[model samples]
Structure formats: C-alpha cells, structure tokens
Target: MDDGRENLDREQTIDRLEEFQKASVRAIEAHGFELKGERNGVAVFTDKETAKRSRDTFRFIAWDKVSEVADDLIRGATQHEEYTGVVNSSKRTAEYYVRVHRSLGMIQLRVLERQDWEANERTCGHDFTPNPPISSISALKPSGEKRTVGFHVNSRQEKTCIELSLASPTAEFLTNPWSFVSDHPLDGGPRDYSLKVIFDQSMDEAKVAESSLELASRTIFELDIRNGISLIFAPRERVRVSFDAPREVPRIRFPRVKVPREVAALFSFASETLDNPPYVFLSYYQVLEHFLPMAHRRDALKVLRRELRDPFFDENKDVTLIKLMNSIERTKQVSEEDQLKVLLRDFVRVDKITEFFKSADMKHFSNKGPISGVPEVVMHLKSDPLPTQAAKRIYALRNRIVHAKDDPKYDSIPVLLPRSTEANSLKPDVALARLLATEVLINSQD
Candidate 1:
C-alpha cells in the first residue's frame, strides 16, 4: 500500500503496471478483441485496421511518470505525432489499447473510456452502424441557421471525419466573413485540426461547436489508439508562448513603489495558465479582491464628502442628520460587487479599457452580452465609462466562477462545467482578466 509515490520508480511499480496490462488484455479478449502486440508504448488490440496504414499511424511520446496514465497525456500532448491510447468495452467497434503509466490511485478504469455514457450503457464511441445512434448532442438544439450535422457510419469503420481534419484548411479567413473553417496546429506542437463552426460575431454561443469538435476528435483518436494522436486544443502561441514572462520594459524601468506580497503572488498566478482559463481567471480575481476593503472605504468617504458639502446642510434637522448617518452605516455591509465597481473606477482607466475593447475581437466587451453563457455577464451598452462595462461583466463572471456546486458553505454560485464549449471560448476572457490584474497591481503600488 505504498501509494505515497516514494515507490514511483521502484522496479515493483513497473512489474505491477505490466501485470495490469496483462489482465486488461485477458478481460478484453472475451469479446473477440485480441492483443496483437505492443508498439511505440501502446498495447495494440484488434481495431478496424492494424496499427498503421504505413507510417501514417498517429504517434506519441510515452509519459515519463508511467503512473500518471494515458489520460494525463491528453492535456499537454498537442504535438503532430503525439496521441493517447484508450480502452473500450464494446465488442462491435474498437477494443483495448493500453498507454499504461503506473501511477497511484488514478489508474483504475471501471467503465473504461471517458466518453459520455447514456443509461450507463458503455456503447461503442465510433460510428459502427449505417446511421449511428442519435447522440446527446441533439439535445443542444443549435440555431436553425442551415447547419446540417451529418452522422456517417460505414462497415469499414474508417476515420472519415478525422483523416480529413487537415485535408483542406484556410490559410486565413477573409475579413468579417460570416463563417470559415480553419485548422490550427498546437503551437510548436501537432495539428489540432480544429473545425470550428461559428455564428455571427455578436452571438458565438458554444454548445454546437464543442459537441462537433469533441465527436470528430474522439473518433479519430479512438480509431488510432496504437498511433497515439492527442487532442490538446490550446496552442502554445496562445495559452503559453513561453514558460518565461516578458520583462524588457520592467528591467529598464524599476518600480518607484512596491506591490504587497499577496497581490504580487496572485498577479504571478494569473499570468500563467494552470491548465485552463477559469483557474487563471480565479487568480486574477484574487488580486482584485486584495484591494476591495480599501477601495470600498474610499468610495464610502467620497459619498460622505459630497453630501456634507451641500449648501443646504442643517445641523439642527434630525431627519437630514439621520439620513447622512445611515449612509455611513450602510458602508459596513456593502457587497463585494459594489466594492468591485469602486475598485475599477478608482484604479482602472476609462481610456485604456475603451482602447482595449476597440479591437475587432475586443468588441465583444464594447457591447452588452455574455461570452461564456453560464453566468450571463452583460456589459453596459450606455454612455457610462468603460469601467462600468468592465465592472459589470467582470464581477458577474467572477461570482459565477467562484460559486462552486460542491461544499454546502461555498455553494453560492452554480458550477461552470469545464468541458462546455463555453469554457473553451474563454481565451478572450482570460486576456481581459490578465489586463485588469496587471493594471490594478501597478496602480496599487506603494
């Protein structure tokens, strides 16, 4: 029971992983799936085709820490040749493939594949029948805007949607085109072959796009488990250009003032992607919260000053005096939402925010609308300053993200599902959070 990982690289770990692979092969063989052999670290079983149709077989690097398992490689494996192995329970379609990394408790696969199951039915993920079974994707009820989704199933079990992923793609789209398909390779990695269907610029809701992408990629990867093709979406050029953050300007111009330790740490946390946008956004929100108390106090004092300076002020009047006293008392119970609005106005620049949102992509925030669709963050489309729009949108998204479904005490917000296409569209939101966090940290220096 040495699961503490002190035994990670011990010879016993390798022996256990080998035993597990042997047992999986035996169990899977019951349904006509046979372990042909092991090649490139993937235990090949009877799929539609043999391991390769020549060298065209998808390839991948074996994860060093074997125990982290094949699924863990699905995260960072965006390279051209890189793929993760999968095991399936169905006898009709594909079968067992092991990209075994003998780690800790994470290795068990009671149901096998990660694909969504219906009525706990572990059906084959591939299109084995002439008309593949209707998917939960239909429940999404996408726009009636002439998008006909095709469900193809051939007796040969070919990778139709997959093999064609990079067949023909746009070099770059025309300016303001209604829709176009583009294949973006993971930055310095392999081709992601992302076939994104889009709507008009104003309403890019995600359910349709996500469902399609997941189905297509999953199909290709499953068909070629021995080849090891991975589906990590974020490009290195996007999520993380480099592990190092740029400091050319900062090196030449030292800060006259210093940021508090907590604020600085949060700023650093927000700068890097901890796997996804939500995690990074949470870190940025933390930096913003560090100043809430001080900003809230400053806002309260401003109200008191404006009220006291009125020419009609009367010290003898009890009604007027009590009203002013009540204003002071209300500050003690002011919501963090109100304080966030104050923080934006007090520290963030209107001109800067307006400039940032003026870009074609940034235009999302210039008008009132929700990007992710979960929290329904609507920016202000009024004559008020840009910070008003920023405050409204940022606060709603922040609150929605912070509110977790689990843990009764922290159950103030609904859970933002990680796999939703809405979550995938968060790159723009991530950019916004990064910009806001940087501004607040620099402004709050002492």
Candidate 2:
C-alpha cells in the first residue's frame, strides 16, 4: 500500500529520500499540487498555498532521491513544507507524506508513526495514514481475517496444474507472508497482510517447492531490506511468491558454471540486504576478496613451475633452494590490492567489463567516479586496464567502509549509517561487484 507508515527506521532521514522522476502525476496532483515546472531534474509543484502569505504561493521543498533538485526551485519552495517520497516496484503504490494543516505556526506532515511530531498535541495522532484524496488510491481489500493465495509451481512441465494442498488441519494457519508498508510503521497499524502459499505442491509429501530454500531465503532477506520488514523462515517452513513472476531462468544464465557454495552465498547475501548501502558494498567487495588467498597461491604456483622447468635448477645446493624459497615468499606476499588485480586479470573478460559499464545505471560510474571516497576506475588498454583500476577503486572503497572513525586512507567517507542516499545510489556499484565476483567464481573453475 502507498500509505505512509513511519516506524523509527535506523536513520529515517536517509531512507526517506523521494525521487522526483519516479513519483507519478496522479499522486502528485491528488494533493492539489500541479507540476508547475522543472529544471535540472526537479519537478516543482505549485499548489494552493498553505498560508495566505503575500509573496510565497508555493512552499513545499522535496529532496529527489537520485538527482538533486534545482537550487532555484528549492529556494522558491522552502517557505514552509518539506516532502520526501518512495514509490514501490509496481509504481502503483507509494509511501510518502501529506501536509497536515498546522495551528501552532509550525508545519506538520500526516503519517502513521510510533510517536508524535515533537510530542505536539496539534499533530494528528499516531496510527494516521496519509489520506491522499482516496480517488488516486488503489488498495487490496482482503475479505476475511486470512487471505487465500494461489502459489503457482515453477516446473519445466506444464504449469497448468491443480490446486496444491497439505493434509494437516492447521494447513490454513501455515501461510507464507508479506510485509505491508503499514506493517513497518506498526504492529497494531490497521492492516491485515498475512498470506498463505499453496499449490499442487506439498512440502509435507514431496517436500518440494518451485524454488530451492536457499534461493528463497535470499529473496526473503531482500524483501526485508527493501520493504523494511524482517522475515525469517519458520522451522519446517516453505514456499513464497512474486506477483506474476518474470520468466527468469538460468538465474546465472547461459552455460552452466560451477561456483563454490561459499562464493555463491556471499554473492547472494550482497543482493539480499543491499538497502543498507555501506555494508552491502563491503559485502559485495568481500565476494571478490574471497578469492584473494587462491589468487596468492596461483602466483606461488607460477613461481614454482618456472623453477621446475629450468633444467639447471638444483634443490641440493643451499643457494638454489634458498632462492626458490625467497621467490615463493615474494610471490605470496603481494598486497590485497595486488591480489585483487591478479583475480581480475586472470578471471574477468576485458571487453565484457566495457559492456557491463555500458548499462544505463552503470554508465555514470565511468563519468561520476567511484562510490564513496575512492579513486576513479580509469580504463586503459595496457598500463591501466579496467581490472587494475577496478582493484584500486574497490580496495579504497573497502577501506572507507571498514574504519569506524577518521582515518587518512578513507576520511572522505562519513559515518551517517543507513542514512543511505549515497549508499542507496550504489546499485550500479553492487552490480559491478556481483559481475566481478561471479566472473572470478565461474572463471576459476577447472
């Protein structure tokens, strides 16, 4: 539901940033606000004035999530209100604020929340959901206390199957779950989102569901991050769903590649909890880092092979043996950055990297420089290839994400936790990390 639900999100400020491009015309207009104009990616709204002020007719300033609003619009609109919005994947639903008229000469926004605005009596009570003229609202009204959901099977065979059931009398009680936005701002916040997952598939009998538990578990974590709801699988727990799920097979796509469980888990883990930007970036980087030890060993193997190939090499002589030992030690003693460089050089495809950055979201990375306080990834053919530059950028970012306080290596990055506008902007970077990690994992195969 698009209705505003306000719980004390870790740092609510950053999570609540509204994107101007994503907000719909209907929702924006419903508040009696019109898209008066736009400049520099900001859509300025001029609605009926909140007060009978002489000069300032438009007085609401909103922060756009992806792009910064025009400074002129901000200065013109900041006479009173401040709005931030978030629209869901469907784009049909939204979670944003509506201005509640103030009597005490201060602005108030109506939203469902645990606490009042500065404990003000004039503000609407907690449990309040934004009343957006109702005409623009589309809500899923479940009939009874529990809603029945048809879970479809994702089989290679004809999916036109029969209804799935379980023998237990308590079958109805054991439904899969979804977290409504209102659920976030409340436990008692009037919304019944409890759902049941069933199909011709039975967990009790066949112990089967379309997607594997490991994959489903990862999806559940992503839901928690995106929707701000915590969902853990119940012991002896089962299946889940997506609304008209897309045709996405070969989750890795194309040729079958062997990736270790550890690497796959790390890669999946990065996707699941990405809303927490700093940690997510770190996690993604760790996917590449996992191969660092193996990378070191590969270098050592090369050194040993070179010595063994030399016909004049002698193990009996102290000088020759000591030289080999010295060579191996030197090979294994490269910096973390150097090891990462080795993995990228050995595993990832150069042209494919150029292709990866060609993505719409990722293109800006080539121009905008690195996320957080890190060096830019300068792509060159020979001296500074994409992989080497990538290593430099990733290592610098890793350092920044690690240290809690001020440090010379990463002082440019600040400590404003999940206040994640910048972190949220890191989807492209995350994708890059996933690409590199998957490449290394797949390419490392025998």
Tens-place lDDT per residue, model 2, 91-188, is 11111211222351111111111112223312322222222211111233333222222111222232212211111111111111113322221232
In candidate 2, position 205 carries an lDDT of 26
Per-model TM-score versus the true fold:
0.46, 0.46
Give the Å shift of residue 85 in candidate 2. Answer: 11
lDDT tens digits, residue span 1-446, model 1: 22122212323333545665544445444433343343334333332243553321211112232223232222221112111112111111111112222341122111122233233111224432222112322333354222222222322232122221211111111001111011112112222122222112232233323333445456546634733333333221223312235545454666665788777787787656555677777788888888888888788999898778977767789977987899899988888877888898888876666656764265454334335422222334566566766776778777666666667764554566453344545666766666777777777764
* Whole-model lDDT per candidate: 0.45, 0.45
TM-score of 2: 0.46
* Clash totals in order: 13, 5
* Worst-scoring 10-residue span by lDDT in model 1: 171-180
